[model samples]
Target: MTLNTRIEAAIDGALGRATAGSVPPKLAAALYHAVKPGGARIRPTISLSVALACGDDRPALADAAASAIELIHCASLVHDDMPCFDDAAIRRGKPSVHAKYGEALALLAGDSLIVLGFDVLGVAALENPARAGRLVGEMARFTGMPHGICAGQGWESEATIDLATYHRAKTGALFTAATRMGALAAGEDPEPWTELGARIGEAFQVADDLLDALQPEAVTGKPAGQDARLARPSAVTELGVAGAIKRLEDILSGAIASIPACPGEAMLAEMVRATAARLTPAHTATAAE
Candidate 1:
């Protein structure tokens, strides 16, 4: 099956199970809305790609891992767009969950997806309990606590922030999980793939900074200049547009070299290049300038 197809099918299957029995109907629907029409599916794609590179001996496990990573990402977005956070009205070019549904439902939906993310890993646990267990632990480590996305968000409220730590936790955490989880899912040593994921995640954050700084809502499908408006630190804020763009180039520059040796190593490197192009905001700074 195609990569996108695999990711979607895995996601659909998980959601189907959640909505199948008696449940809060609105929240169930909100869960679907939050994830469907995925934005790039970057995390899952990396998960699957790393799995493929590692032979994907257990396809079901790999699929579950990818879907789980994506579910976590969707959950993060749902919470991020709530009134307490970015209060973004639009996500993936449509109303965010809290905007379309009520705040209570949106909050519930995000929490549900986070639980579902861990639940998704159960699909292959019986097949390889050891690998599945490792996947769960690794995912948890990156999704919460001192070094996860939660910590990333928590840093925002601090009196002072370490920009690098903030970016690494806020964004790099998941990409790191994506690569490691993919390798773990496929029964490979995940350690070697760490640098590639970190670099890609950092590059993505830089690109997102550029997007938020320079693109219009119409161009980016979400509120722009949020970094400036919210006083959130960003690449564009730290190092002007040109400097941020150059930094993006610098981050992506070493990504290929970081890929661990594997059969699909060349393919993974190519994917990073393509991702870099896509990361470039639609509205070029020069065009706006």
Candidate 2:
């Protein structure tokens, strides 16, 4: 099967299993709604790409890692769009979970997805017990305390925020998990892939900042002007529009260069370039300038 299909199927299967047992009807439906018709599927794709590059001997483990990363991402989006946060009405080009279901159900769905992420990994562990521990540890480190996405969100609540730390945690963390977990799933040394993931994550965030600044909600599929609205730190705000674009290009360049030698190096580089192009905000900054 194609990479996208594999990722979606894995996610669907995981969600199905998690909700099949005694979950409340509304909560279970919300969980499915939160993840369906996923946007980009970038994290899981990256995980699978890295795994393929490094000899994906265990497809099931790689799929589980990818799905787990995406579940966390979707859960974060649901919470981020709540009334307490962005209060966005749309997500993935449709009504957000909080909009369709009540705020309570949306919150519960996000919480459920978080637990399900680890559960997916647990199921994958059955095949190879040794790698399971490391894979789960890497994901948790990126998903929780210290320098995880939670820390990234916490920075927003503080009087002042560190841009690098915030960006790394909120966005770069999952990319790091994607690469490292992909390597771990393939029985390869994950350390070498770390910088590549970090660079890619940083690039993606910068690109997102540009999109938030330059694109409309219709095109971006989420609220525009969020950083400005929320008084959140953004690369485009910190660096000017042109400067953020330059930074994105620089980071993507570094990401491509940082790819550790693997059989699929050329293909991976192409994928990064294509993703960079796709991620560039619809309008050139000159127009906004």
Candidate 3:
């Protein structure tokens, strides 16, 4: 199967097995709904890519780590789209969890997914205790308050913030986790892989910011202009369109350079270049026009 297809199948399978049995029917349905159908699956693909680059002996471990990362991402989306947060009515090209399942269930579903992410990671770690411990610690550090995505989300409430700090927490944290955890899952030292993820994560966030400024709801699958509307600090707001694209290119170049020569280096490089190109100003012109 293609890389994307493999990642999708792994995610679907993990979500299915996770939500099965003992979980309340309503909550299970909500969890499933949170991760349905399609997404770029970029985070998990990054995890799997890094794992393959290190070694492919434990695809299952990599899959578990990727699934856990995705669940956290999906859960974040559920909460982010709630009336309390972005108050967005749509997400992933459809009615958001709160819009479809009501505020209470949506909240619970997000909570459930967050807990499920830890659970999945716990199981993965058990099979390889030391590596698993490292993965858990990295994930916790990336997801917890004051330094992680949760803190990134919390930044919206702050009156003052910098673009780098904000984007690092909001988007880069999970991407960092995806790459690091993938390395850990493959029994590789995660330190070497950190820069690769950080660069890519920064690039991804810049692209996302550019998209928010230039793309439409139909294309982005989420409310566009929400960043500007909310006064959220973003690369586009801080650096304009052309400037943001330049920043993205610089970051992508750094990410490619960080990838060591390995079997999967080409694939990872391609993914980074493709992602960066997708974020360039020219690509946004058609969407803007």
- Descending-lDDT candidate ranking: 1, 2, 3
Off by over 4 Å in 3: 278-282, 285-289
Q: Tell me the whole-model lDDT of each prediction, alpha carbons only.
A: 0.91, 0.90, 0.82
C-alpha root-mean-square deviation, each candidate: 1.2, 1.4, 2.1
| Local accuracy of candidate 1 as per-residue lDDT tens digits, 1-289 | 9999999999999999889989988998899999997989999999999999889999999999999999999999999999999999999899999999989999999999999999988766877889999999999999999899999999988999998999999999999999999999999999998988899999999899888887778878898889899988888878888898888889898988898889999889888888888888446657435
Please give the lDDT score for candidate 3. 0.82
Model 2 / residue 5 / CA error / Å: 1.1
Q: How much is the lDDT of residue 20 in candidate 3?
A: 72
Q: How many angstroms is residue 239 displaced in model 3 relative to the true structure, after the best TM-score fit?
A: 2.2
- lDDT per residue, candidate 3, 40-142, as tens digits? 7788878888888888677778887888888888989999898878998888898888988889999999988888788877877777677667777888898
Tens digit of per-residue lDDT, candidate 2, span 1-289: 9999999999999988987877689998899899998999999999999999988999999999999999999999999999998899999889999999989999999999999999999988887888987899999999999988988888878887777888899899999999999999999999999998999999999888888888888888888898898777788888898899888889999999999999989988988897787787447555446
Which numbered prediction scores highest in lDDT against the true structure? 1
Each candidate structure's count of clashing pairs: 0, 0, 0
User: Considering only N, C-alpha and C atoms within 3 Å, which residue pairs clash in candidate 3?
Assistant: none
Of 1 and 2, the candidate ranking higher by lDDT = 1
